[model samples]
Target: MIYAQILAGGKGTRMGNVPMPKQFLALADKPILIHTIEKFCLEPRFDAILVVCPADWLSHTQDLITKYVTDSRVKVVAGGSERNATLMKGIRYLQETFGRHADDVVVTHDAVRPFVTQRIISENIDAVLQHPAVDTVVPAIDTIVQGEADAISAIPVRSSMYQGQTPQSFNVKALVDAYATLTDEQKASLSDSCKICLLAGQPVTMVRGENLNFKITTPYDLRVASALIEKRA
Candidate 1:
């Protein structure tokens, strides 16, 4: 069975004055995480969803689920301190509850990326089915330049550059095994979950992503997201 794991453990340090985590904050009449969860829940291909949140936010997250989702297949579990740790915890739970032999297609996504459309989700799922080593990423659109300190150093071609985003879909066993091998230093430097699979010498295939799926990290991001939602609505 395909499972969607939403990582919602961020402390919203960048989004100053947002009383709650960015994911839990209201956007377009609902919590941002709920919008993300609802997108996957609407897809029949996803059998279940696992949301990883900080331990202290468990009850609040549960309340949001009860209000918005109401799907019995949804599970809210306490998350770990770091992003990778929280993801590992969610993977362990999926393995124990659903059994390791289950179809093993796992999609790990950022809870704050509420605008990820169903088309993107389906495209990534299809790619994973065909390519054993595949990840959903969007190419860098603007010109690329490398800078050092306060000056431009090099102008690298943007043709081959892409910014990574989630939901990074992978075979459950493949991802679990890759993450299991991460060392303390490796985990510390890991910025995204897909990197874990790549560090294991796995090639990641890219799928186009919506610009609106950008993560809400700061006040400006929240403003942009809110504007996008308003524009779409």
Candidate 2:
């Protein structure tokens, strides 16, 4: 039961008062969400491609899919309050629709990240087979700084740090069971779903990602995406 979970729940606050979320914004000839979904649709291994978005925008997202996507694997559902919560919504949907299996894999991705390559997706899917969890990352090019209250708290070694990207794959049943064992405090501490697997003692493997595979958040990123698309054309 391979799945592609596209997380698209945000309100686009950082995108500076847009009429719609960043994922719905046009990137080249299509909406960013459409572009992202199309990438997964190309990979036929996925049994389902779940597009989880804000409840308020559910119909809007569904309409976009109907108009732009020809693939029957794509299904839109309202997302939860937070990213991980949205993921749980997807996981539960998979459970109800298909039931859970220990080896059943789910490759989770950010809907705003339209540039994620097929290589990244394929790597994540392959990594999840041997490990309970997989995270897509690129070697950090800039020195990472940990700060607190306008002051540098710590500076991490650049060589050891990696920037996380999406298409984080996991054994669906393993993640569901591991998530259940977490305490309230542990849940709150999680920055991403892979952390739940880590906190609960499940091993997470890392896959190399491309630098251009970025999440389009700000106007600058949108501009970059547009240019990239034009170049592709």
Candidate 3:
């Protein structure tokens, strides 16, 4: 089975007290999450679309799905406080509802990143067919620096650095086992899913990501997303 686990657990605090979470914000005529969901729905490869939303917004998420999504495969569930927790909840639900397979693919994505292309999603699915895990990444176009307090600590090799993007796919059993190995401390520090695979000593394949596949974190990103949609239209 192939799953698209959309994580929308954030409070949207970075968006400065918006009435709604950033994922629910309208990009044009549709909610940001609807756009994201539509991308996965169009692929025809996903067996089910699972959305993990903040507990308080679970009903609201359902309403959005009812209004915009015609695919009955979409399912909504309450998400946990952190990214990893949210993902764990999602995977557990998948296992309970549909059963897990060693070769099953789960493509976890951010609900706010609506610009993820079908190409990237397909690439991840294809890559994971050979490797147990796969992550999408774009080559860094700028000089990256590691800094502390007031000083630059180190300058990483520009050629080697790649910015990670989502639709990070993994074999169901592989990911579940990786998360099972995480200590409490490591679990609390979790941010990226690919890190879990790496910490478990599993090899992850990298697929090329597009420049437009950026997460909508701040208000500026929302505006840029709007402009991109307009340009596309």
Off by over 4 Å in 3: none
lDDT of each: 0.85, 0.91, 0.91
Q: What is the lDDT for 108 in model 2?
A: 98
For each candidate in turn, the TM-score is 0.93, 0.97, 0.97
Q: Which ten residues in a row have the lowest lDDT in candidate 1?
A: 128-137
- Candidate 2 per-residue lDDT, tens place, 1-233, comes to 78999999988888987899899999988899999999999997899999999999999999999999999999989999898999999889988998867679899999999999888998888888888899999999989999999999999989999999898999988998899999999988888888999999988899999989998989998999999999999
Q: How close is each model in CA RMSD to the real structure? A: 1.7, 1.0, 1.0
Better of 1 and 3 by lDDT: 3
For residues 1-233, what per-residue lDDT tens digits would candidate 3 score against the true structure? Answer: 88889999988889886899999999999999999999989888888899999999999999999998999999999998888889989999999999868788899899988999889988888888788899899999999999999899999999999999998998989988988998888877777998898988899889999998999999999899999999989
Which candidate's lDDT is highest? 2
- Model 1 root-mean-square deviation: 1.7
- Pairwise lDDT winner, candidates 1 and 2: 2
